[model samples]
Target: MKLRDLGGVVLAVLLLAGCSTSPVTEGQAKAISSDRVYAPDLVGRADSESAKATFLRDEGYFGSGCSHVIYVNNRKAFAIRQGEGVSLRLQPGEYSFRLETGAGMCPNIATSQDITLKPGSAVTYRILLPSDGNLRLTRIQ
Candidate 1:
């Protein structure tokens, strides 16, 4: 291959190598927690007073009443709630949170939103209900 072509190939490989899902370095993880507040909005039946909040840990779902979510840093998932706000400490990176709502009479109502968190940053999102009873995600910060 031509020298220029070979160099281009090497550069491409390096760029792709930088894209990985491994947890951030220890220093980076610590920095992330201090830098940002990862708060997502929780909108629900408008009558749900359980303060139910759900988040994804290394194991699995940590709480109940979590229907919708926002992925943060590819490492954590924040669940949507109603009224009351939810909070969590997570490593820095990119995430996608899937928003959901109640079932049965409220089954058909659901919505989701995406958010990206940087190291040492706080993200505040919103959960709201449409007039028709469907749910929608709103980012506050």
Candidate 2:
């Protein structure tokens, strides 16, 4: 192959390597789940005044190989893998939910929404990562 052709091939390889979308391994996922530290005030106490919130990821073909970090009320809640979901019991109040791309992955792909939770109520939110690489939060319930 010509020198110029070889250069082109090398450039393509570099670009593809930089565009990695590898999914989180099982061990990494477990570590992420175990490393989460919730606020002490938010830990126990399930009662009539507590509200339930569920977050689900889209798991669509486009970005299903990547994991995202979820932040609740500006606190690091947990990491949500593709097609996975998590539920939390929170005190009835207003909360802000945000999603971000995992480390070494896409940049500038964060989205958030504010929701008010009432006692004895349950709410569900879905995270969508479209082709544009921007995160979208939608309320499905």
Candidate 3:
């Protein structure tokens, strides 16, 4: 094979590797629940003593159909499917949210913000899978 052709093959392999999707294991799938109900009308109130935070993974029809395991403050919170979401009532404080597929290739993705929750505030975070195949957290509210 020509040297140029060999380089092209190498580039293709690398690109495919980066675009690979993490497979959801049976245990991980079992750990995820699809029963969470999202109430749009219910949110944090100004007079309330706690805040409401919701994590949504809205991949629509473009997702790989794999369940993504979510971790809040290092504890297994719940799993969400495409177009599904989960919510938590939290005290006013700083928190860390992480998402992982429990796959071997794809590493855990986390929120980049300070994630400070204030009393009577409601925040919604959407998990986005961009064209580059990396997971990102974006605040929609």
Candidate 4:
């Protein structure tokens, strides 16, 4: 109602806005440091019935109930060594990713995503090469 009162209110608002945000440092953001990565030991195999390519839950977080199915096709294919497996470390957020065996079940792909990973935790997903081959799923603590 008064000029002096209005000026005080504006000053308070400005101060609050100024204190709202501060630039984040690397340490504070927790950017993926090399030390935080723990590659999971995944073993690939073929499906028994189909005799096609399939990945099984072998080591690490295998049997931890984090099992999932993923499809990898020529379009969205991610190359993985025949014997050597791959690992990914994700922070707290929602990630959409695709995995492929690099080689067919009609579409020759099983896709899963919209995965909500918790902070400081991980999940394991596998793709079986053969219908009955050994596929390994592992999670890291």
The number of the candidate with the highest lDDT is: 2
Model 3 Cα RMSD, 1 decimal:
8.5
TM-score to native of every candidate shown? 0.42, 0.66, 0.59, 0.33
Q: Global CA lDDT of candidate 1, please?
A: 0.41
lDDT of 3 by residue, 27-137 (tens): 232212434322222232334778887776653333455457666677666666755555677778888877666344445554444588888788877776654666767
Per-residue C-alpha lDDT of model 4 across residues 21-80, encoded as one tens digit per residue:
222222233222233222321122222321122222222221122223333322222343
Which 10-residue window of candidate 3 scores lowest in summed lDDT? 23-32
When summed lDDT is taken over every stretch of 10 residues in candidate 4, the lowest stretch is: 46-55
Report the Cα lDDT for residue 30, model 4.
26
Q: TM-score of predicted model 2? A: 0.66
* Ranking of all candidate structures by their TM-score, best first: 2, 3, 1, 4
Per-model RMSD to reference: 17.0, 6.6, 8.5, 19.7
Over 54-74, each residue of candidate 2 has an lDDT whose tens digit, in order, gives 766654466655668778888
User: Following a full C-alpha superposition, what root-mean-square deviation does model 4 have from the true structure?
Assistant: 19.7
Which stretches of candidate 2 lie above 4 Å from their native place? Answer: 1-45
Q: Model 1: residues >4 Å from true position, as ranges?
A: 1-81
The Cα local distance difference test for each model comes to 0.41, 0.68, 0.60, 0.35
C-alpha lDDT of residue 76 in model 4: 27
Better of 1 and 4 by TM-score: 1
What number of clashing residue pairs does each candidate have, in the order they appear? 30, 0, 0, 33
